[model samples]
Target: MPGSLARFRACFERSPRTVVLFVVIVIALYVGIRDIAGDAIIETLDSHYPANEPLRDILRTARNYHRHPVEPPYKDKFWEVGQRSRNLSRWLAELNGPWGSQLRGFEKERLGTAIETTATSLFPFLSPPPPKQGSKTPLRDLQRSFTKDSRGIVIPAGGSDLQIRFAGHLIASLREVFGCSLPIQIAYAGDSDLPKERRDALLSFDKTNNTEFLDVWTVFDDATLRLRRKGWAIKAFAALASRFEHVIVLDADAVFLQSPEVLFQQRAYVENGAYLFHDRLLWQHSFEDRHEWWKDQIKEPSPAMNKSLVWTEDYAEECDSGVVVLDKSRTEIFVGLLHIAWQNTWAVRDEVSYKITYGDKETWWLGLELAGSKYEFEEHYGSIVGWEKEGSPDDKAVCSFVIAHTDEKDKLLWYNGSLLKNKLVDPNGYEVPLYWMMDGKWEKGGKKDMSCMVGETRRRLTGEEISILQHSIEAALRVDEVIASMKES
Candidate 1:
């Protein structure tokens, strides 16, 4: 202990390289041991079994929500298989080194089981097996809804480049699937360069097909247009439309999973004035006391309804504009209300204006309330889900529309998967499904033969598709790394 500093200085000076090597060895040993221990813990957790009854109940409930008919007795088996497959897949993804080689086998077995279980459960829902003979009857029926003599318009608000591309993809998908010759009217609103590219893409498609592309700049005067944003412009156009039965003000990123004609059957519902929204599973807790802006407008509940003031008893439903389907009358009323609500207020962003003035969630609630309009709430299961990272459950059973919001790129995988599977109950035609790329193989069986469809259409990725996916994954990882590093820093 005597002269410890002097003694330590002497030892380091004599064996600096040896000391550095010793430190490296210790660090490596610690990391290796930690990795081993972590794997063991995860493995142990995976081995633990939950009681069967509760597990099956959860699976049965989820299945029921998607309109799938499942026998009560088989519910336990369904849950067990799903849980086991998910666990093994996750565990295998976590393993490292020589021991990790075993993961390949586990992943294949579990993934296959998961697919089989999901497919089997989904099969009955397919109704009459896919028509062996292609029926032009359905297509003809869809066409007659809107007179060939009549014209229709779809005004999508384009904000970002991704938004424009998404709108293009939706239009392309619709055209390919339906073979509908309806003259599509597209209006893109944004900065000169981005909108030009967007308009070009849409125009390119229109040139080959029969459609009209209207650039917002061409339609609007300099002063009037400058006062409004892209989203507002689209809404305004929808408000002004005269003869269109259904004026769809879709956010640029919302994609059409099924034929747009499914909406036409209910055309008269929204004809006079009806608001269509993707139904959100309202958690009473989430809306508790969250909306403050509407507090002054509505009577405050006893406990402030959890924390948001916007939660009013009048409307338990909330609408997301990502995909709004409304006829001309409803469009006129909503647009007029929105204009008056924001006229004198310091206009923040579109979503913000709604939130600040009426409490974001309550804007639609208030609009519907004031309009004295009865909304025909149609549940298009696929229309809206928060993005993957947004942690909305993969309610594939209920999803009819895949709304690509803040993150457009991730939704590409979902869209591709749906298209390739031909999952939509389209009266038109089926497109190829895309998720078979995950395992580089596919199997056939279960509902809709999604497995077979995925496998048959699966092809070795060309240099470009592989490159795009790889780049996307890497970019996402880099973003996560930056976020984590910032947190640590």
Candidate 2:
């Protein structure tokens, strides 16, 4: 032990830079390990180590603490290192040993601040590498093209004439009902997806022309990605192609009760840089293939996976992608988005993701989890908004295809079936349902595979909610009227 100490001392004396780096790593390890183990190990150490024990002994014991069962299974070694370094500043400032305790409060603060600066300075080297998607537009390249200061809404539309109509109502609700002035980008794969006339109609949604049309095929190389001219798979790729640093990707059929702009201020989105809504808790114990596929795909243990209902509750689905909020400037979110784009790319979507999950929905949260990106889902599961089946038992589910989501405050944030009773059945209809049902424990699938709310709980919208919905419906109707007029012209 003395000989080993002599060698270490000699090496440390000969190479001061190497010694400094070694100390930083050990201190960082202490900070990270302590956080996971919490006060238990600290208390244990305080009891076990005598006050007269050497500082080296205390550190060696602390280093051994990582072997405990509490170690976090973070796959990215760089991320683990960065996390360790980042926490060192606070740990050092709060250091309370004989020499450290002698430091004044201000002195400790200054020292902590310096450590923090050094830790952050190392971040460029420690940051997680962009995911290797092997796409035409790599995440690193796309990140370089990001408009860091811009924020906006992006809707992947122009898949069909019907989708164009749905997007019209969505834009109207955003501008007329919610009074949101954020620039709206209608993202399409090519001119074939959205013709000139359709582009003009979408642009007309906002009188000030705050809307712009994005041909994603032109923005991104389609040879490698093969973005379909029409499909739900285009959604994630559209978000990646968008120039905005902060983006809200809304489905063409999505209708909001409140301004989606408020989502930017949501505590979840503010902290995590990605906010997603939960899909209805359905298909439990079904889709074993999908469950197994996810298990095989996510080889690394993840905290996000632990929190997800897909794993914890064994639900087949979790995220509803109708309304997705993302801050692309964040490395984690950007990388996660890239993973989502890769998942939805032509080959992967057709061969794996689509076969496992119904559409592009499940891919959202799964990709984020796979990339270890921090994301928050709406606290509540989706609610059904439609007519309660007449003559059916009180406990029977509401017979509607609409899936509505609520915020932390339990207020209806948005619903995804559009204003019509059934958009596919009656495109021009403006009938909006009043009663929204929740706590749907049982879902009965129709021949068309549409899940009906057959649960035993129901809730009527408050007068304010109903009133706002009515105004939103009215805004949608006006958009319909304008589209009709444009067609006549």
Candidate 3:
């Protein structure tokens, strides 16, 4: 090798023109390889970490032609890897039909910035004084653990009725994942919200822990805001009315798969003061209904649509409003999103205000686009474990770290839902290697063709693990009964 190198050097020295040509060829080859590798890696990350716009905007925002006003880029390899596997599922599902009732809404509601500017412009003259929201916190008992600047979690239970039913699991998971590192609160809406007994049941998760509840009407009784049906108006109210200075607005269905402490530490939150996750589905195809709800809400087109950021072919999901973390620093941005939601679509006959079914999310997306908010949660991508489908011989459900959920929050819900239909088949509880989120994608198992992300064998929880999973939900339910029986006695 040394002699060959010396000979090559001598030949190069002997012919200056030949050496220059060789150098040019080498440089060209390097650029070609670099471009290919960059594209492949980026595509992988984009397709999987569709929500990871904040992270992807590292150079794009500062230097790209299109401005990305969101958070910094994500550097976590494992998270990106896990997101990719789940993302692949999202893309595959996108290829499938929206199914039955979901087929009605195929287009996303688009609001031009010009329309929003016109609607909000009337706020001063037409709107009543914003609800009198003071810092008088309801969860004063937990004040000892939190401070004026501390962040907290807010789970909204609109008339959905599922939040309370799943309270035990949510609390248990929060405890296991967050360990009371931050204060927690529940904001419920609807005249027929939670009964006193159920509310008490939720607080019973921890004898030492106490949570705050909101009547919602106290903050969002405005006639203009009444158009919102999902009580998201209440959530919009909590964005400003809540006691905590910073809050992580979480959907009840956004069960804690793991600790979300990292969310608070993001550049969007730390630097820009605002952050939100990307919606998994965007564009006209992701919408579940065909109703043209925007016509009545605003008099004009949405001006912000022109500059809005969109998902690339690499990423599948774009915006998920279900989970968000924002501080007072970013309240303006949050409010921007709220305004659009409030002003969009007037109630049709028999329809609630905001007449739109998913007006909250639609508004949230529009508001961000209008404000050009840079902080986004999609950059910190993650997924839940479940089963998935594959071809013929490998058609059976495979227990893997899948991205599946029946909830609308799920990006690949349709696809994952279908695959998970077979269920994680394990009666006795076998020990398949655990699907490690930190490991990103699943581990390979020799050459065995498993239909999972890593393309290996399927895995299932042991009886103990299954029991534990079931127990969390059961425990919450049992506690409700225990307290009721004790009171009766």
By TM-score, who's the top model here? 2
lDDT at 69, model 1: 33
Over 4 Å off, model 2: 1-141, 393-397, 447-457
Question: Which should have the higher lDDT, number 1 or number 2?
Answer: 2
lDDT tens digits, residues 1-489, model 3?
Answer: 999999889998899666755665565556746344444444344444442343243222212211211121211121222222222222223323242223223211111111222222322112223454332322122222234676777766545434554444466556643464666777765446756766766677754485767655454444544524545555655554456767777666454433556567655567656665543222334433322332322223234332233322222234455666666433345334343333332321124323433445544554444344444444423333444433433543343422322222322211121111222342122222233221133332222233344333344434554444454444444544655574687
Top candidate (lDDT)? 2
Query: Model 1 misses residue 415 by how many Å?
Result: 8.8
* Candidate 1 residue lDDT tens string, 1-489: 769978767888999866655555555556746344433333333334322332333333433333333333331222232233233223223332343354456443433333333432332211111341232232112223333224354645366544454455455545554444555667554455244544555655443466565444443233333333334434443323323445454444444433455444454343534444422323334443334334443332322132221254322334454444445333334332333222212232233433333323234434433333334433221122211211332422222223212111212222222221132343223222222222111122234332221212223324543444344333333333433454476
Q: Candidate 3: which stretches are off by over 4 Å? A: 1-148, 158-161, 176-178, 227-233, 279-317, 340-359, 380-384, 388-489
Where does model 1 exceed 4 Å of error?
A: 1-151, 190-197, 207-209, 215-245, 267-272, 287-292, 298-317, 329-365, 379-489
lDDT of 2 at 334: 67
Candidate 2 lDDT, 353-449, residue by residue in tens = 6766788898788777766778988777778777666566465456676788887787788899788877766666576566777666646555344
Candidate 2 structure, TM-score to reference:
0.70
